[model samples]
Target: MTPALDIAHSVSGQPWHWRGGVIDGLSGSFQPDDLVTGLLLSRGCARDEIDAYRTPTIRSFMPDPSIFRDMDQAAERIVAAIRAQEKVTIFGDYDVDGATSAALLIRLLRGLGLDAGYYIPDRLMEGYGPSGEALVKLAEQGSSLIVTVDCGAQAFEALQQAKDAGVDVIVVDHHKCAAELPVAHSLVNPNRLDEEDGAAHGHLAAVGVAFLLGAAIVRRLRDTGYFDSRAEPKLIELLDIVALGTVADVAALHGLNRAFVAQGLKVMAAQRNIGINALLEASRLDRAPIASDLGFRLGPRINAGGRVGKSDLGVRLLTTEDPEEAKAIAAELEHFNEERRAIEAAVTEQALELGKGQDNRSVALVSGKGWHPGVIGIVASRLKEKLHRPAIVIALDADGIGKGSGRSVAGADLGSAVLAAKDTGLLMAGGGHPMAAGLTVAEDKIDALAEFLDARMADDVTRARGERALQLDAVVAPGGVTPALVEALEEGGPYGMGWPAPRIATGPVRVIKADIVGTDHVRAIVAGEDGRSLKTIAFRAADTPVGQAMLSAGTTRKLWVAGRAKIDDWGPRPAAELHLEDAAWAD
Candidate 1:
């Protein structure tokens, strides 16, 4: 548990720790400088599992779909609908994960000649999850079956309403579930309390679960000779959206999820899906997107539609076949994204100002009337990042109903706390996974909810904050931070969430020059004792402690910079630069 370096504190006021101990007994075939091997070992891969971890694949990581509690039943029902040509609708949430999950199923059903319709509730009017009214209306609209993805684990009344309306509902979700299950035709969630065999994959996004159902349906069709006259749909092609949702949802990247991204990126590069192709072009990303692009670029654009514009635009863009329609939708989404950015900036500023007074509380909970509920989740994320603690942002309507979203730091279970609050009558509606959650509460009870969360999560927040050391995968000299090193390190990735990209500490060097660049980024040049200069930039840090330290170093003070080494592809020649995260004085 000792700090990676001899120094105990960095300029950011946190220590640096090695991600893992010395890696030994790796295959003899690997050279001493094989960074991928080292990265795998440091990330908890066993020596014998290096080969499997090196190239994660669905064939290697995918489990039996039938092992899930209701997977088979759900798939069978969907296939039966396809056979009977029954009207079907996909009910999804108003986020990237929901959009992608609904789109994946729609595309699959389209390939099977079903042409299933979709429903995404307006964020402002309908809020999160499928309501009883929405479900019963869909049933009354002649739809005989509905599939709710990325939500519905807590829709006790909604499911009951659907049942009473005589329409079957299948829940394909990954949210944490309470012990008392809702009344659905089938509920397929790996995180369900009764899920034993499939619970190992509790990290899957809703799209991941839908992908399993797709496979199961395909398998069932093949067994029943349903594909004897028609060509079976290639389910692998759908991984593109699966990858998009899994990353956008910020699901952990390991095991099956890693394979989904690693392979999905390849499928995306093929540009078979017209909707995705238009999205890539609209985002002005000329090259195939990496994991980061999905989260930062395309995902946000899709989310923008749900946040500020029409909620169905994302599902439409992802499922459309008309090139002109795709182009127009993509362009509209881009505009919405810009509008969303402006609104988010304003809300984030206000939330941060309000959060300034909550340093003593275990959670930073802020609320304001007339704030856009669509942007509360993003604002919560920003607050959590700034405060380094769990944060919740609630937008209260004129009627005193509050729509709240929360983001949690590592080791703090925000979703469970919200669920506990709902059980105790503090929340009217709430449920989510560990990292993020959504809820509804009365404006009058906001203070009580805050106090309940403070008491429940105080110990967890303290322990997580006390262990706030930056983790480094390796240490390299300034000259060693080259394009080759970046390439070597990438063999261990498609990194996101749980499977973190490797970070290296490079320095014991003096700052040669430093200046504020675009927006609030700090760009600097530093030279090691060997006289090799390296480029580094700390994004959105010009006003922060690390940025201030780098700006004041002024070629005299020596320090170590820790960050991910990435190749600067925009340059004439590929060179490496550090996306600096933290720094510590060496002398």
Candidate 2:
């Protein structure tokens, strides 16, 4: 609880705190030298669960699929369809999570010898969720059963239309739900208002829920002796996609989600999934991907299809059997990702300029008439990061209809606020989880919506920002920051979202040299009192206070540099470098 290194504030104006409280060598079950144990404890893992956290396994973290509401019914319906060889289509959102969920089910069904079709709604034409027209069209096309993944939780009218048209809709999603549910035959979401025991897994991404459904379907088939002759589909093989969707969606990495990623990475390494392997090659990643690669490299490429190119490309790439087709899709997605980055950069610049005018408001709500709707979510995320507040970027069309995407800071429930606004008639359509949300609104109501959110979330934003501090897992001198330490800390990984990588503070060092490298990155070499020099880079911070401080420090001023220690394998011999996040003046 005490301030780390006796400093009340860092250069970024935030205090640094030891994540696990001050570690006393003799008091706790773990010794001070056991960095992994300390990291596990700081991340809310119990002392008795150290071994489990160290090696997260599906068997240890996964819950029985039957624990969720409607699990048995959904599985029974799917098994029946499998037995009947009936036509079925998976209706998914046009995002990474949706693509992966659809791909997982399609692949699972393929292994069962029942081919299923898929539909991903165009982001620009059909919007975020399933529309009544699309659902009915799929039914009219001879599909008897439809499964909507990553969406449909809020598609009240769409689901009703499907029901009226004699189509059974099974909704497997992870979004927060309203008390009055939609008219789906089965709605399985851990965040359901009526969820009892399954609510413990509210942090699952939609792909994770689909993975559970996969397990449930397999179990039902096993119970019916359907797999006695044919081998049961190895559901574990699908964890690679599950991991991709889970990390790409920024779901909390703990428990089952953690196990999904940890094991998924291994499955990914096997190169069994032709589509994933092609994507890896397209991304120029020659080695097996870690958790960060999913979020940054692979996830973005898949999302680029939904954001800028053909919406179904991701699903097509993931579910394709032909390696050549997979390679072509991956290449196309890479091109789209590059285009997406350009559009996002332009939108972000304009949004940031507009955000400066809203400093008095709790939320950075910005809208532009000509802004591309596809890139608003990424722009909103960028705004949230820079402004240190909840942000919503709305793209208004000529008809005065606005499509908005929002990203929230920690402890601020932007999704709930958006949902409340919809309930109060401020939003025409809206739904999301705690961290991110999407909405449709009349452009005229933008101001009122902003006002409503400002009033509703002001206190939460204030408290969350007020309590913000740079959390440090360990503090060591520059000499102690080595490849060995970085490797040791990795034992606590595949870290992300709720479960973060260990942040090490190594300081009492003077900057030996500093320069701006790659656009907006501050790269520096610093040496401590022990005369040991190390490299540090602060990405996209050349214009920020931390970057400015590091650049101007020169060789005279001693400072504490805090960041995630990573192994720099680019050199002839592996060495350690700091992906610096924050720094403080030590003298």
Cα lDDT tens digits for candidate 1, 1-587 = 11246547898889888887532211212244467878888888889978888988899999999999999989999999999999999999989999999999999999998999999999999999999999999999999999999999999999999999999999999999999999999999999999999999999999999999999999999999988999999999999999999999999998999999999999999998888899899899877688989998999999999999999999999998899999999999999999998899889889989999999999999999989998999999989988999999999999999999999999999999999999999999999889999999999999999999999999999999999999988777777788777777788888999989988887788999999988789999999887989999999898888999899998888999989988886778889999999998988
Model 2 worst lDDT window (10 residues):
23-32
What's the lDDT for residue 223 in model 2?
89
Worst 10 residues of 1 by lDDT: 22-31
For residues 65-170, could you state the per-residue lDDT of candidate 2 as single tens digits? 9999999899999999999999999999899999999999999999998899999999988899999999999999999999999999999999999999999999
Q: Could you tell me the lDDT of residue 74 within candidate 2?
A: 97
Q: How well does candidate 1 match the true structure in TM-score terms? A: 0.96
Q: Please provide TM-scores, in order, for all candidate models, with all chains considered together.
A: 0.96, 0.97
Q: lDDT score of model 2?
A: 0.91
> Number of backbone collisions per candidate, in order?
0, 0
C-alpha local distance difference test of each model: 0.91, 0.91
Which pairs of residues clash in candidate 1, taking residues 3 or more apart in a chain or in different chains?
Answer: none
